[model samples]
Target chain A: MTPQPTAASSPRPVLYSFYRSSCAWRVRLALNLKNIPFDTRPINLLAEQNKTPEYKAIQPFGAVPAFLEANSQGPALVESVAILEYLDETRPELPLLPKDPASRAKVRALVEAIAMDIQPIGSMRILKYIGKDKEAEWTSHFLKEGFSALEKMLEKTAGKYSFGDSVTMADLLLVPQFYNGIRFNIDMSAYPIMSRINSELETIPAFQASHPTKQPDCPPELR
Target chain B: MTPQPTAASSPRPVLYSFYRSSCAWRVRLALNLKNIPFDTRPINLLAEQNKTPEYKAIQPFGAVPAFLEANSQGPALVESVAILEYLDETRPELPLLPKDPASRAKVRALVEAIAMDIQPIGSMRILKYIGKDKEAEWTSHFLKEGFSALEKMLEKTAGKYSFGDSVTMADLLLVPQFYNGIRFNIDMSAYPIMSRINSELETIPAFQASHPTKQPDCPPELR
Candidate 1:
């Protein structure tokens, strides 16, 4: 079932996230897509505040997107897919995985290809580690390789979404990758299948709402 | 169902894999754990053979660990998680996910925390791009942070396996990171929880079987 919509007096879920983090953004998109309203607690990575003992208690990894469960099991959690899956399970009305095993596996694989292979190579943390000039080349190389692979996989399974008309967790993944690509200046047209799916994803309120520029923590000037 | 044991005459599953690749190793561990036999078609990352048109056709991104599915409705897929998830689905006797959603999310998150954050930062490919000396520092830094987070998470969820006693997908992920730790000479003792899990994982036939030294593609001297 979909999450209940946030109202004026209701307590919203707390999302410990940063605007630039693709992982955090994925959760935001999932929550939005599922219509779950949450307050954002920006963790400033640049300042290294995430490393403080206080924040470390909340997110040991010092990463953004440690989700605080509204009223259930435990405290906040780290990792995007885990959070998304948690949301999917707790609210089953808008399903993220297919009923069958094969389809679910296919969808999860498509998402991981981007999450594991592509995004990690080009993330800002890695980019900073690589330095400025080489960052573009590094990102371009990964995007080129990853998009090509993604294209072939998408061609095999494309319908209205990454696996069919229904938007599964795969779609939640693709949109963020698309945004990362644009930031790196990789031409989306290079992969037609990705472009088409991305185009379709743009129309959905969940994706549109979760865009980096739209996040509450986004620099007002940048937004 | 767990995959049926292979026979000498059985057509082995074709794995596009590379040595020293955590992602590829995840699948390898799963296959070995399940007692499914497989043949390796090594994708030489150093020579960039994975980028060749022929290889790209099999895996568009040219990432290693693409499984050659002979009878599946969908084409051969890439991504370690997808492959592992697919294996779990097709062979349900040895389930990778917990029956409950919260536990499953915790397990998946543990895997992703390593896969997405820790493993990617020190990727051999990325390291090569950054040069040798600097790569080690970056690798150590990233791994330490990721592992520390994992240690805490594991403490909360530990039993015999990463999540309780069962060897779910999270254990598949842990073994490779341990390998990476060994590669970098990072002290495992730093994280007591991880060391405990590592000790437990090594005893399992599946994890031991899929190690880099056992892979057909590993250099004889290294093996």
Candidate 2:
């Protein structure tokens, strides 16, 4: 995939991200799906480069996926979900949210279920809290619990995509979270519907280009 | 506030919530603010009401603030952010998200910053993970860090509310998270902007009525 300029006559929107971070991946998927031109500045999260003074000036949180809207009035945005929504709004050719309100809510719920509930439980720092040996058990427990709700909800709202096939913002969120589940070795078999949607999503250029293994900063071992 | 008939209108939207849970409080605020009528069935977390067979069937995760969509095609939606977005969508008279995408993203990010970053670190379970002795320190650290970001964000976004002069979804989210900060005995002096926003929000019927202290199930000590 060729990198495109974010601005017509100026530099592209710059995304500071780590390849493996699910949150960052969410933004990447959104940018790709919208065909928005962006430049990727891979932050060395593993190397503690995010904590440096220069990086801290842009993002106090020191989290990956901070976005710099070169021409936006406000300071650069730091959170991933915020960046995704902003991109969707600023460029709406292929929108992330559904046109209808109820559908939009369902999509947001699906996205938040993973981002808020499942992702945090399986976070690296939390694993460090319980030690690695127990991390497996912890991750498994949350995934099983979260996936069941997701599967049930999908059955309720899904058609071709997460919400009646439009491939709204929920799909962007679902793919990376599924990747997280796979990373933690959580069983996906129990979520056949989720797996099917993810399988469908993987073939799309947006998801394909956004896969962590495909990113410029992806580790050689993972690649 | 009188309850509004849910979409289906067969039965009122049944809110399965716990008294002290911040997620539950978010929904309460939305319901009250929207003037939607609903009956609340308290699920005592301490007594494990959520883990009951019937409750677990509705909420696989056994968390509070599960909304049984009275008439929607979808199943009971979980997650506070999702629920609030749903309410805002189905009842669009008083909008929760802003008109512009950039503004909406800003609001969602503010909500997520609290829900994803601050709320998770200080959750009852996380406290358990850090052990009782260190829990206070852990909670205080995250609250202050989150408040610092929130203060900056609110300063940028605040007019009369968290994201503008309008009472947006971010204000609804900000209230409960701020309550958590107060609960943990975190000093609010540094977060003057957030403190002011919270004070202003407290005067509104939406936020005032939803205070957890007013709930029937709220413990006297906690209340």
Candidate 3:
């Protein structure tokens, strides 16, 4: 796909991301999958770098995975799902969404099953704010409940990845959430289809390169 | 836009929705905005209708706002954002997404800021699960935090609605979340831009008709 022309000569897209943020990981995987040439500027969530005014200027929500388009025509896009959609639109070679509207909807529903239904409730900030005592239990319960439904959906959808053989938006969404499930020590044995797809996606270079441990700001111990 | 032909002489799209569910409200508003003919099958979330096997068969997540398309070939869509996108694509007459990719990205970013960042955490299920004691406090904090950023975003994007003069996907997303923020008693005075846009959108017939109180399932006291 030809890069969309911009008014000003644009530099490489810069991704403001945090190493361990699952949301950030989704965009990194998308950039690699689309083979979009880009650079990363790590925002340390632990250090509260994301809350600083400097970072807030890029993303008003102060969230990581803010995508600064090559051309500085508009504000840097926040929301990982939005960034993924933008990349897919601007770089449409390996289409993340299917051609058929219904098929595209199915893929998107699968993505949101994880992104909206599961991830936000289990996010660090939410869990921490709710209380530190039952974080593990809350995370585990929601993950199990979400994965139970996702596993059923994947039973009909998965071939090798979350939706048939190709790597679509669903797969990009799954891997990061799957990582979080592992971090929370959720019982993965119950979700056979998701587990299988996560393993298959792990073999791909795009998925491999975007792993949290491989990111530039990954802590020494984690690396 | 012409409705795509389907086998078995497909019926009008069926929307499984609830009156008070902000997520469902998003899809309801979208269907109205796109002028898609759909029948509502109200699922009483308070009654746990969404948790039954019958509902789960349609949406594995067992969530309100499951959209069963006119055709039966594809699975029912669960996520409101996904359902909105499908409606916009399949019924493209009054385009919900902007023609330009950059403009579309801007609209999508605004949508996700609410759908992903705000709604999930402020959801009834999440608040109930966290504990009833701090529910008000928790909801209030998250809404304030989310709207602060959204207010700033609208400063750059809003004309009459979230992304300019026309009713775009951003507007569809904002109205439902704004409804929730108002329910939580978040001080709306802080978010003047969002408040103004939301009030303007409320005047539109589509938005007015889709309000939770107007839905078939709305209880008399609430209505």
Using TM-score as the measure, the top candidate is 3
Give the C-alpha miss distance for residue B10 in model 1, angstroms.
7.2
Q: What is candidate 1's CA lDDT for residue B30?
A: 83
**Candidate 3's residue-wise lDDT over A1-223, tens digit each?**
1123232325888888899899999999989988888888889988999888767766778778887788675467778898888889889999998899888888998998898889888887787685888887788788898899888878767788888889999999899899888888887867888888999999999999999899888988989
Write the residue-wise lDDT of candidate 1 on B1-223 in tens digits: 1122232232567777987688899998888877777778788887898878777666666677778654433255677888888888777777888998778888998889888878877776667767876777877887887788888778778898788988989998898888788788788889877788889899877777788888877889998
User: After superposition, which runs of candidate 1 have C-alpha atoms over 4 Å from their true positions?
Assistant: A1-11, B1-12, B37-49, B70-74
Least well predicted 10-residue stretch by lDDT in candidate 2 chain A: A1-10
Model 2, span A1-223: residue lDDT tens = 1122233222577788889888899998988888878888888887988877667556656777777775553356767877877887778788889787666777887888778877876776556666777877777876777788778668767877898878988888889888888888988887988999999988887788889998889988988
Residue A130's C-alpha lDDT in candidate 2?
65
Which of the predicted structures, 1 or 3, would earn the higher DockQ when compared with the native? 3
TM-scores for every candidate against the unseen true structure: 0.86, 0.86, 0.93
Question: What ranges in model 3 sit over 4 Å off?
Answer: A1-10, A71-74, B1-10, B71-74
For each candidate, what's the DockQ? 0.46, 0.42, 0.52
Cα lDDT tens digits, model 1, A1-223, are 1122232232567888888888888899889888887888888787777778777766667778887776533456678888887898888878888898767878888888878878877776667767897777888887887787788778777897789889999988898888888888999898888898889989987787888888877889998
Give the residue spans of candidate 2 off by over 4 A: A1-10, A128-134, A220-222, B1-12, B68-74, B125-134, B219-223
> Candidate 3: deviation at residue A50, Å?
0.7
Give lDDT: candidate 2, residue B110.
85
